[model samples]
Target: MTQTHPTFAEKLIAWQKQHGRHNLAWQVSDPYQIWLSEIMLQQTQVVTVSEYFPRFIEKFPTVQDLANAEQDEVLALWQGLGYYSRARNLHFAAQQICHDFGGVFPENRESLQQLKGVGRSTAAAIAAFAFGKRETILDGNVKRILCRIFALDGEGKAFENQLWDFAEILLPENSSEMSAYTQGLMDLGATVCQRKPNCAICPMADICQAKQQDRIAELPRKKSVKVQEMTLYWLILRDKNRIFLQKRPQKGIWAGLYCVPCFENGADFHNYLRDKQMDFDDLHECATISHRLTHRVLEIIPYECDCKNAAFSANFNENDGIWVDLTDLPQYGLPKPLQQYLA
Candidate 1:
């Protein structure tokens, strides 16, 4: 008799049972925690999410608790986590669940996808892990895994559609195995099938088409990303123990966060000061800082000034800026670099 081997899903499920991450904080069968973890994991590392997840759950243990909380509180708790939009969406989705889903998480992928920030892969993961539904997840890690396993070479919607189809086809026949199989794909990609994959230790090494074809490095094609650079000038006005901060606009980078007044350049800052007829001859240029975002690098230049005895209360009121006590600065949501600078 010819030797028989387990199918891809069987091998993955077996590997996951023995070696996958089971002690993760969000591994429980709670949809709320699973959903929150999935959203946080997008474009972020597992280690980072692990740190944030516990604090978030501690603050809002239930979806209703999250829904009732203020946006500022949510954003403040989500501080230091880049991509503030995810925090916003998670809050919004909680409200949606309470109002639309009757405070219960949707049981299936399609209904779950209706939640803001919950995409197809996220919905599938939530459904599988929380409800033991037969679903497939094709997140970045799973996409890379699929691309390498099948020796796929393409990019754009067509390539993504192919991956999605493959993802659906690769689902284990038994619904009970969905959770382990899904986690297996994530664990395999994150640990073994990385950019520089460790093929020797990979359970799917024998079956991976890329390994057989000697194209593991070339299987998953990625587009080149150019990181743009920008310069921002911040005015740090301090009066005694209080520092001035303005709420950033609701759109663009660092949206809905509190920061010192920012300008595009020195000329802009000078023009703004002139327009407001505010002059402080004691303005001192502070050290410049560079903050790197996913697609852009910001060079921040800060100008500090002591505004003691200068009554700019009326001016600040008109500009929606507030003087916050240094001791109470932790109450507000601030950009990571600004938080570091202030610290």
Candidate 2:
């Protein structure tokens, strides 16, 4: 008998069955859980999402439950997770599903894309894992793997379209194999074909064009990013066990989350205290906090002031600010650094 080797899909499926991640919290077939996991996993590490997944599911067990809850509550549960827009979008999408889809998840990739935050790759992943639909996912991880394997270079609309075509062409033949195949791609990209890949153990090592050409490190072209710097002075006004917090604008950094009143500079912060006729001597400067976002680095200087004897202006209303009890802090969605400072 002539010896034969397994095909690419077959090898990946076999490897996934033997060595891929199988014990994740969102590995179940529930579309709600899968959709939630997919959204959370975007721009976040698996280990981080693993910790938040069960807690979020516990808080809102069903699509209807998530939709019925207040946005503040949803944001509270998603407080520690950066990218506040994802939480907002998740809430809006849950409501959309309840109203438009009758609280049922769409079974196909096309319909899943109608959700606010579900992109092409995310929709494909949800359709494949939850409904057993044969769909190709072309997320960042898959893109890196494909780029290396094909020795592809360049990044533009053309490059993206090429990747989508390759992803679709590589789909497993059987619908039953979609889940494992999709997971295999994810596993291979995340563990084996990472930024610093371990090509020795990769199933694609033998076939990768980049490895063959000694250009594995140069195949996937990286776009240069400019990280901007910002500085903000935060006022931590405390009256006994209660702290003053203001709601951030509906757009921009930390949007819709509660945070201590922040000014662009120390002068503005001092002016606010002077305008309120509050004594500046009571203020204590806390250590500066440096928080880094995807493309911005923030320097936060906190000023602690005891406002036990101070009276706010009559013009100040609930919309401007409110005093929250320290014990009830968890109920409000606060920025991670601010939350930590308060804690």
Candidate 3:
């Protein structure tokens, strides 16, 4: 009888057992921790999430605790995470788990998808990692790995179904090994099969179709992004020890977040100040900063206008915003770009 060679899952599992990340802060079997890590890891790197995860868990130790916490507190904790909506959705999902599932995360993929921010891939990850469920996860990293290994064709969402099929085929048979197999794909992609993949050290190097064909960089193609540029005028109004910030409408960019009062251009800003009869002791242009989002780039120009009196004029209403203590600015859930500017 002829001896059979190891399958892709077996090779990946072997590689993971030897080289995968096993000691991360959220490498536990707890569903809550797994869910948190999955959400945090979305559009974020492990190194960045590692810093915020421990602090967030310390505050909300349990799903019940997270459900009971305020949105401001949640956003404050997730201040620098970039995607503020993730924090909001996580809070909403925690409430849902508490009220709908009795504070226990659903062990099945179907029920997990009902939660806010929990997509098909994330639900699969939580189910597999926390409950040892035999579900396939096709996140960005795993997608890259599978695409390169099989040399998948098409671009963007066009190849999603094919990728999912590959994911299912690569899933380990034993449910007990689900966690290892799932994490293996993640680790292999993140550490070895990255954009500039170190194909030499990759466990799948021997079999990767992209590597074999020298098309690793071109296998997992993406949709072209056209970044739109917009200019913004920020009035950095300060009085004594407080800085005036406006609460953005709860719908657009930086929704429900605090920011400096913004205008489209310098003319609009000056007009608004003139109409409000607002005067400053010293007003001058500060350094300009450029912030790039997924599809939009903002050219932010700030005008530092110092006010002698800490009190706002009678024309300023409650809807405008509040004057926060300069010392306590970091505690607010400001946008990452704004936070960096302030810092």
Candidate 4:
């Protein structure tokens, strides 16, 4: 006998009300705080984001403050959070809020989507939390849980759009209820319907298709990804008291961050330093450090510079150089694995 499938939205929200995350520090009124949290949480786990969110919000309390801030400052706050380009987009979005939107995040979805870094999920979160709009959320967690429950089979974009259509349909009429439900779905996915989910006591166990088919883990089909390896030459300049840092172009990896110079290849790297007329005693700190992204393996060759008290440019307009105080290195952000390596 085929079972009558019931929507688990109410059950999830009720469970959320009874046993959901209530005291997250990032759940604040200021759109700036909310926006910061949304960005930090992307492609990142809640447990991981928990440590970074509050500190970031305190540093950049308002969108105006963020807009006025320098790229290095923003990127430093975003240390450990991969996808550094998102921080750049959020920074530019903040600036747009200040100039284009008059320092207030848009109350509607259309304009919010126009802002940098505010994609569907982030925009939905902001609209629901900040503006009390009834926008649906379709993050990874949500997709996993929903796919398992509905037995959605297609992979990649097909599966994603299916879930989105379902999400929009289930958005509650009241924004307050929608907000609670949205958070509830996220909470359920993160805690109960996990990667290796605990479906036995799940609210939807009564009607879950994955449970019926005994394939909970296999429901959220994803497209196969091809990982590419990119080679990088990282030139580290140190004058004992300081290390030279540079701002990456406002696009691509490590955008809006401070770090030693990086080159696409050895020849390009040598030419960069030569063009700047900088050559002194140097130390090869390590052969290479590997930083892996979702679809890329970045092999970095780290070369450390020692000036031997030889005076160089105190402050030059070199895109490849900024002398950062050693004691104040924390002010400039390093990548997560890199930070651990540094320590």
Candidate 5:
């Protein structure tokens, strides 16, 4: 509760039983669903993920189903969820679990951690939520809470591990309530002990170290990195009333999502479009969108082309591009840039 006082886990967990996210759709006995939700939640907001979670579970209800699914299909289901690697890794991990763990998700923390993309926080989440293991969690929320509560500063990759150790120390011996404790600590940071925290309702309000020091806003941060720069040219060619959409390859970024044929600045995007087999009479460059990635910033230059002298009966290659009906755009998941062009 304080820099001097100890063991805040019990109080947080106790508060959690009465005031946490209990009605979330993923709180159940199924390990696959819990694991999938945790994977999806990494660096993704719960509000965005909430819409996809139920649909995902309904589509691939079991680990084997997910494992057996085409990589593109999985990526399609995870379109717009960003951090595409999570979907890829989830598929790889499911296969491993099926082959090695009898088509069942591992129950304990150690085994779960061995699965692909199952890092410490994720492993602890699956263990605690599914098997009620008392493994402590130190996700982004917990790290922020701990860093502020201790008035801690400086970036340490090992800081989360250290915080987990502290969390374990603070955990009650009864240990029957890990699910509540883990979720509660996260929710407290999310709702009460927030970035601009409303400390009045915080269970640790009277004793939080950052509050005592009057430095709540600047407790947890790392040195900032340089943002990468990218420039893209998007060719949104349309025939009749259908706009062009291409399926990205299954390996790179936006894999399995639809896009207008695009190229980065270093590459010849105009030349690439010229090589395409389309009957276009006009090309107009629309305004650009500044697209940001975790490591790079992209300037998307959209070009609108009106096709003529072409029937709606030609097929093309090197161009996975299709003429999708604008009215039915939502039926297929296009990459964000295409969706933005439509918008």
Candidate 6:
């Protein structure tokens, strides 16, 4: 009888057991932590996510706790992490789990996918890590690993479907191996099989088509890149020691985050001040702030205006906005650029 070589899942599991990240802050059976980590990890590097995970977990601790917290609190913790929508959805999903599922994260992938911000890949991750369910994940890291392993071409929908099929096929048979196997693929893609892979130590290097074909760099075809630029004006209105901040509407860029009064242009700011008959002095133009997002570049021009009357109040309550003392700036959830401006 001839001895058989171990399969892909076997090699990956072995590698994971020996070298993969085993003690991440969120690596546990607690669905709340898993859900938070998965949401945070999307489009974010693990190192960055690691820093935020502990602080968030320390604050929330449980799904019910997260659900009960105010949105502002959640966003405050998620301040520097871009993509504010993810934080919003995480809060919404926690409430949904509490209201709909009795505060317990659903065990199955199908049910998990129904929650806000919990898409196919994230659902699969929660299932595998939290519930020990056998599911295949096709996140960016996994996609890169699989594409290199098979030397896949094109980023079309059909190619994506093929990758999913491969992911499912490669899943291990034993349910207990699901966590290790899933994490193995993630670890490999993130560490060993990255864009510039360290093929020497990659357990799958021998079987990776891209490595064998001398096309590791080209296997995962690049997407077309386009960047758009936008411009806006902001007013840093100050009354003595307090700065006025407004909560943005909850459906667009930087939604729900605190920001200074913004307008289409400096002319709009001037017109608003004139119309309100608000007395101000020491009005001076500040430096232009350039902020870069995934696909958009924002050119923000700020006008610093000091109210002449120390007794005058914007009088905007919490429902509209607030006059935050500069000393208490850290208590509010602000967009990165705004935070930088204040800092």
Report the number of the highest-TM-score candidate.
Answer: 1
Question: CA lDDT of each candidate?
Answer: 0.88, 0.89, 0.85, 0.77, 0.78, 0.86
Q: lDDT winner among the candidates? A: 2
Sorting all predicted structures by lDDT, with the top scorer first, yields 2, 1, 6, 3, 5, 4
Clashing pairs in 4: none
Q: What is the lDDT of residue 14 in candidate 2?
A: 94
Global fold similarity of model 3 (TM-score): 0.93
Is 2 or 4 the stronger prediction by lDDT? 2
Off by over 4 Å in 2: 1-6, 265-271, 279-282, 310-319
Query: Per-residue CA lDDT of candidate 1, range 1-343, in tens?
Result: 1112349899999999998989999999999999999999998899999999999999999999999999889989989888998998999999999999999999999999999988898999999999999888887788888878877788999878877776777788898898899899899989999989999899998898889998887878887999999999988888889888998887898888889999877788988787766774757988999999999999998888777666664466635588899999878999999899989
Give the Å error, residue 147, model 6.
0.8
Q: Could you tell me every candidate's TM-score relative to the true structure?
A: 0.94, 0.94, 0.93, 0.88, 0.88, 0.93
Q: Which residue pairs collide in model 5, if any?
A: none
Each candidate's number of clashing pairs is 0, 0, 0, 0, 0, 0
Question: What is the Cα-based lDDT of residue 133 in candidate 3?
Answer: 92
Summarize candidate 3's per-residue lDDT along 70-93 as a digit string, tens digits: 887888889888888898899999
Against the hidden true structure, what lDDT does model 6 obtain?
0.86
Ranking by TM-score: 1, 2, 3, 6, 5, 4
Give the alpha carbon lDDT tens digit for every residue of 33-152 in model 6. Answer: 888999999989889998999999899988888999999999999999899999999999999999999877789999999999999999999999988898999988888887788777
Query: Which lDDT tens digits does candidate 4 get at residues 214-325?
Result: 8876777766889999998877766778677776666677765666777888789877777767663445657678878899998888877666555554434454467778
